[model samples]
Target: MQDWWNAFMPYPDVDVGHASTGPLSGLRLAVKDLFDVAGYPTSAGNAAVLAASGIKTATAPLVQALLDAGAFFAGKTNTDELAYSLIGGNVHFGMPRNPRDPDLIPGGSSSGSAVAVAAGLADLGLGTDTSGSIRLPAAINGLIGWRPTHGSLDNRALRPLAPSFDVPGFMTSSLEPMAAVMSAVGMPATNDRPISILIPEDIFETIDGVIADEMIASLRSSAMPIRKINSIASFSLADLAVAFTTILQKEAWESNKTLFEQSPDAIAPDIAARLRAGSRLDDEAMREADRIAALFSREVNRLLCENMVVALPTLAMNPPRRYAGPDSFAAFRSACIKLLCLSGLSGCPQLAFPIVSRAGNVSLSLVGARSADRMLVNVARRLSTCLKEQMPF
Candidate 1:
């Protein structure tokens, strides 16, 4: 049977045997094409680029760690062209179907990875979260998506996309596999403990009213005291978005300028346009972005000091329709960036949990201080338990 999900790479499946015994033994794993797999070409979802780039000589250390810990490698999965867009529709490889809602888009560039896990095709899907790539898809597809603190996971042998913001992340059907995968990858072990929840009034307001209310209600159900803060220090969502976009564009241009110049016509028009814009950014603009980003990071770290977690909607609204027009997608993308850019700019750890609202399936996100990746997962697990007991909330 042909898989309508269209999650895996078009090539034949690559099977790396699972360990006889370990934490993840018997677990199925699928990787985004951006991660090198020894001899396979790291396509990054662009056919021409794949044709131009030769096979990788080494496997990414993160993928290797999972295999060593007993996870079976399934195969490479599709991704947005060059891992650039968040919409998930690759002009070349086609978008992965949203297991929860086929009509809605499967948020990307990590689109296939999330779908693979959501559809039960893979127990764990390894992806890269540059700015909500993992979190957005996880939320849209009703799964748990986690983006660790910048540089927390090894990145060697992975394609670069806004290096400063790009971090290894994953999507899983449930928290147990996510926790297990994190443990295998050398994530510091953390004890399960209750943490304080902070609701950033400004960020939550960015989400649609119905979705925001649903998320807030979930937080209320938790015994953790929820504090309403006026702002994340002085930084607004818009400010963070601008700073993050500027830096990302500048860095992306630097990383892929050569590819753009070599085969401009081979890339998708939307992605090509973004690269062109990035090429036009000046050093002064990047410097200003850096200054703003540093300030935002410092403020976020201060606010999230140990034991504090901030909750907000993962995306401003639900995922855009699969065939949404360019103009409609542009507006949706802009609003989403405003919320997602917070973590990218601040370099904090974030986890998105699937939550339903009147509008439809939405995701609630929790942001924590640097090095709090494990803590965020633990908190999500505990909260899941609480929500289950108080079912039909």
Candidate 2:
């Protein structure tokens, strides 16, 4: 039933959904393999990790909250092994099919969750975002992905991947379901729209020229007007990417080295080598990375202060074509990291909401101040309401 996209993990016997009437009463929830479910196994999409992770004895706090709010459990979805890669092709469990085109990589490590939601198999897909996992897949699949502020929610029992960047996140088809999930999870109510748009000076130049015009035109749409716009100082994508990679690699190496070391063949050879390289970084490099990260966090927060949100293209180009050569995937992934690293480095809340045009479907993300998750969603809800329908999400 939920397997058409290979999105839901192959587990039919572990049934655990609380039936009650609440805010999310009619929604079916898809949990990513990174989170624990009481009766289900958290495979984390790797054969070796699966062998080590026995059946979870308790449900994670966030998952329990959604279930308590009356969301029907669909099933645990697949993820990139140890949440490492963004391409979403699991060498172990097979890549989840992208329902949108079927030929594009469903941006991951939240691959299955995004595929399931996009395929109409579930209404809400609970995933994690560490450096664009949620946003990338949601954008590629034409869905709304929300990455909340780091540590803003109860994140117990989650397998860590770069603890400083990991945040529990979700993807949904539209604005309403996203709002419902937010309210269901006990987030505070938002009455007023928190919107004062900020555009980076060189964003258009940074992304590929192919869709740059479409993104530019979206700014003039009634949904996101340029009437009240201001310019935020630009940032170097290359510098940010390098700094982000340094921190992410060090943390990932510390968190997941043992798993790969214990079962080297269980993990992909390339990823294993990456982890090893991260472990080998000298202390001086690590210190410089931390310094840059801290400085950027302050700079971004200051710029996005007082309800101002930065709106930009969710991706640099588009999802890599499925089954493409390693070179193609690498170039696309690198370009995307430049676009996405700021959100992770700064710990801001980012919402990847759909923007439809004759150029086809693309997403524009609103990056807001930390802990302003509800505010960002409410702002987008207003925009979606005003935008022309039938534009094809």
Candidate 3:
């Protein structure tokens, strides 16, 4: 029989051919393809990118940290090509089936990382969420995925799409390992007062009905009640979507322009088209996007200050089906990318807890102020406990 994981499958045999062990001995890890892992090819879910870039010699610091913790390297997982899209399908590597419902998407660019953890294939998996890539998949796959504030986790030896937004993140089936991974990576846990959660209805609009209902029920049952932020003005998610897309495409184009120029034929057609679009962006548009990003960041900080954490649906819609046609794929793919940016724009820490399953899927996300990652992880730990007790997960 053919292997179910296909090209998306990671190398499971990892002993590193060495005799070193430490605290996290026997634990398994799946590193996203975007992160350099000594011998594995950084495919970034595209054959062309891998062929052009070749194997990376160094391991990311986060990966090294895990190894120091005594975790065995499982292998590299799939990602959205160039870490650009959120939908999991790679035109090159076949998309991994979501463990919840293979008919639906697994969510991306951290697609394989989420699937690996959700399916119990790995104890922990590294995933990069440029735009909800980490949290969205965790929500869809019933895993705990955390993104630390920018720079809280190092990004060295990793590929970049938007340097400002991209950060190394990880996913696990439970909060315990998630916390352990974060702590081992050097994020200090700080105890806080009572937990305060902010619920912004406008953004919550993008959440599916089943998840919204479950979250509301969860809030009502919790010892701490959630507060609605009334003073915050709503920016058009659509407009923000446009701005976010334009800025990222432009930035990605600039960052990878050299590669594109050297071998335009090497880049995938869809990605090449996106780079062409980014090329059209003038300095003025880029500057305007910067202005908007700054403004939005300030407002987001204020909303998060009122509460220790802000809660939102990790993905706007249920995991979409794997589209067969290019047009259908592009449309579904774009929406997922835009929604992923909500947390990405903040550059803050996010902890995605698997609170409840709806329609055989999961939904849970915790957004925190920048540099308050440890506290956010604690909040997720408590929430996960309450969920397990109430929902019997």
> Clashing pairs in model 1?
none
For TM-score, the strongest prediction is 1
TM-score of structure candidate 1:
0.96
lDDT by residue (1-393, candidate 2, tens digit) is 838788988875677968578888989999999899998888888887777788889999999999899999988999988888889888889899999999899889999999999999999999999888999999999999999887887889899889989999999998889988877776676557435677675666777676676566556564553533333434477887898899898998998888866887888876787798789998998888888888888888888776787878898887778999888878888898887888898988899988776668878888888877888887777656655552446
lDDT of each: 0.85, 0.84, 0.73
Please give the ranking of all candidate structures by lDDT, highest first, separated by commas: 1, 2, 3
lDDT of 1 by residue, 1-393 (tens): 256799998776555555778999989888999998975778889888788768677788899989889988888998999999888899888999988889989889899998998888899999999978898888888989999889889999888989989999989988889889888888887656667889888887776776677678877887767888888868667777888999888888888898888888888898888888899998898898999999888988888886799988888866679988998778878889998888898899899987544565567788998888889888887777776666564
How far in Å is the alpha carbon of 165 misplaced in model 1? 0.3
**Candidate number achieving the greatest lDDT relative to the actual structure:** 1
Each model's TM-score? 0.96, 0.94, 0.90
